[model samples]
Target: MKSNDKLAIHELLNKAAYGYDSRNVDMLVDCFAEGAVMSMSITDGDLIGPFEGQNEIMKLMTGAMEGQMDTRLHNISNIFFEKEADEAATVLSSLTLTAVENGSIRLLTTGIYRDEVVKVGGSWKISKRHLDLELPF
Candidate 1:
């Protein structure tokens, strides 16, 4: 893959994390393609969802955002590319989630994000994402 594509993909992943942390709905929506899918697993428990399509995924995201009263920090790191092409890539990254409420900050969880992204109109957008959490947040 080209270096620019790799950079763009990295930015895309960071943008998603930032969007969620900042509660920027529009930014989060832009990160996903129309048919995007998302799922999660916590501590080897049952799968949460294979939330199909952008609308369903947004419902899940917005719900989570509304439920949280604290400030969230979703730190994305250790990004690696498992596969790449001109228009698509599979990426794996680590998440260290923290929340701040009042004067206290707490570590919520750590997780892994596996994402399939495609270039849509010259921008990378997540087509599929699966998250595995070490603990429930």
Candidate 2:
């Protein structure tokens, strides 16, 4: 891989992690494409749905994170990127999330993110992302 490609991948991953941790809905939306998909498992059930556009993605994230007095730290590891073309790639990464709530910091979740990314306007954006989480039952 060329140095520039490595840099692009790193930037993309960092942006994603930062966006989520900061709870910046707009930033998160910018990381994905129009009609992008994001799904994850929750205690209630699987929150599986497609976010058709950036506006919808913003609404989903804002509503989901609302009223949670929690600050999250995203530790992204084992990122493997497969080049699908000059403008696209498939990436897989493991994530460990730590959160602080009620003055206690703890490991909140662990998950894997399978993502399809495309370069849009010279920046990598996620076209699809599936999050599979592991929880103790």
Candidate 3:
């Protein structure tokens, strides 16, 4: 991969992590393509499904955050990227989430996010993302 291509992919993935960690849904959605697909499984509460399109993805992600009254943090690590072309790439990132809920702070979840990224209209966006949940709660 070219240096610029690598850097661009890194930036895209970093933005995605930061956006999600901060619960910034708008920015999070900005990382995705219009017809992107996202799937997330939750071990607690009511979050488990495959959401298609940017709108649905936003609703589900933002909705999950709405239930939290305390702060939460999603830490992403082990990011790996491979460029398919100047306009496309694949990214894999592992995440560990911790949140304070009902007066207790505990690990809320852990998972791997496998994402397909594409440059559309000169902007990087996620074409698809599959979240593999690993934590029991």
Candidate 4:
């Protein structure tokens, strides 16, 4: 991959984390493609979803946001490309989730995010994502 493409992918991943951290609906919405899908597995348990389509994915995200009482920080790290091409890539990264409540902070979970991203209209957008969490957050 070109250096610029790598950087853009990194930025795209970080943007998604920042969107969730700040609860910015528009930012979150912008990170996904129209037909994006998301799924998760917690503690090696059964698959929680393959929430197909951007709307379903957003519904899952918004519902989680509503249920939270603390400020969340989703730290993305160890990003690497497993495969890449001009229009699409498979990426992997680590997630460290923390929550702050009542002036105290604690680790909620750590996870591995496997994402498939594609260039759409000159920007990288997540087309599919599957998160494997070490614990329920």
Candidate 5:
């Protein structure tokens, strides 16, 4: 893959993580394509969703921003590009989540994400993302 392509993908990942942690729905939504699908499964909180399209994703994110939790932060690292092409790429990233639940601060989750990102409108956007949790909150 080209250097710029790699860097662009990294930037996309960074923006997604930072935006989610910051609770900026617009920023977070901008990282996805119109028909994107994000399926989330977490052992804690009994949450499993196969959110389809940007609207559904935004709805899910809005809940996260307004949830009863005191605070939540999502950090991404150890990104690896499994496949890269002019139109699409498959990437895997390690995830670390910290949050305050029931008024006590705690490590929420540790996991990885399998993402399908595509170049749409000349920018990289997530077409699909599936998060796998290693531990619960």
Candidate 6:
């Protein structure tokens, strides 16, 4: 992979992570394609989604961000990728969510993110993302 391609991918990942940490819905939305999907596994052994479309994705995230005293710091690391072309790729990374409740912060969950990313109109956007979590159970 070219250095520039790697940089672009890293930038895209950081943008999403930071957006989530900041609770900026619009910024988080901008990191994805119009038809992106986000899924994560919960403790009850239920899987969140292939969230299917942009609206569904928004709903899932918005619901998580609303009426919650939890403050989450979504930190991402160890990103790896397989580039299919200049326009398509798959990425994987590790994530840690620092959760705060009642003014105390603790490591809430650890997970891995699998992403399908594409370059559309000269910008990289995540077309799909699924978080397979560990340690929340």
Q: Residue by residue across 21-53, what tens digits does model 4's lDDT show?
A: 899989998999999999999999999989999
Looking at model 3, report the run of 10 residues with the lowest lDDT sum.
40-49
Q: How many collisions between residues are there in candidate 3? A: 0
129 Cα displacement, candidate 4 (Å) = 0.2
Error of 1 at 18 (Å): 0.8
Clashing pairs in 6: none
Total backbone collisions, model 2:
0
lDDT of 6 at 49: 78
Tell me the tens digit of each residue's lDDT in model 6 across 1-137: 56686789889999998887788889888899998888888654688777877788878777877856777888899999855577788999999888888878899888888998988898889998988888662
Q: Give the Cα RMSD of candidate 1.
A: 0.6
Candidate 4 segments exceeding 4 Å error = none
Off by over 4 Å in 1: none
What's the lDDT for residue 70 in model 1?
96
Tens digit of lDDT per residue, candidate 5, span 38-102?
Answer: 88676534557789999998888787677645677778899999988888999999988888667
lDDT of each: 0.96, 0.76, 0.79, 0.96, 0.85, 0.83
What is the Cα-based lDDT of residue 52 in candidate 2?
Answer: 62
lDDT, candidate 6, at 25? 82
- Find the 10 residues in a row with the least total lDDT in model 2: 42-51
- lDDT for each residue of candidate 3 in 34-87, tens digit (9 for 90 to 100): 999887665534556678898998887788778777777778778787446777
Clash number for every model? Answer: 0, 0, 0, 0, 0, 0
lDDT, candidate 1, 13-103, per-residue tens:
9999999888898999999999999999999999999999999999999999999999999999999999988999999999999999999
Q: Model 5, stretches more than 4 Å misplaced?
A: 43-47, 100-105
RMSD of each: 0.6, 2.7, 3.3, 0.6, 2.8, 2.0
Task: Name the TM-score of candidate 4.
Answer: 0.98
> How many backbone overlaps does candidate 5 show?
0
Model 3 C-alpha lDDT versus the unseen true structure: 0.79
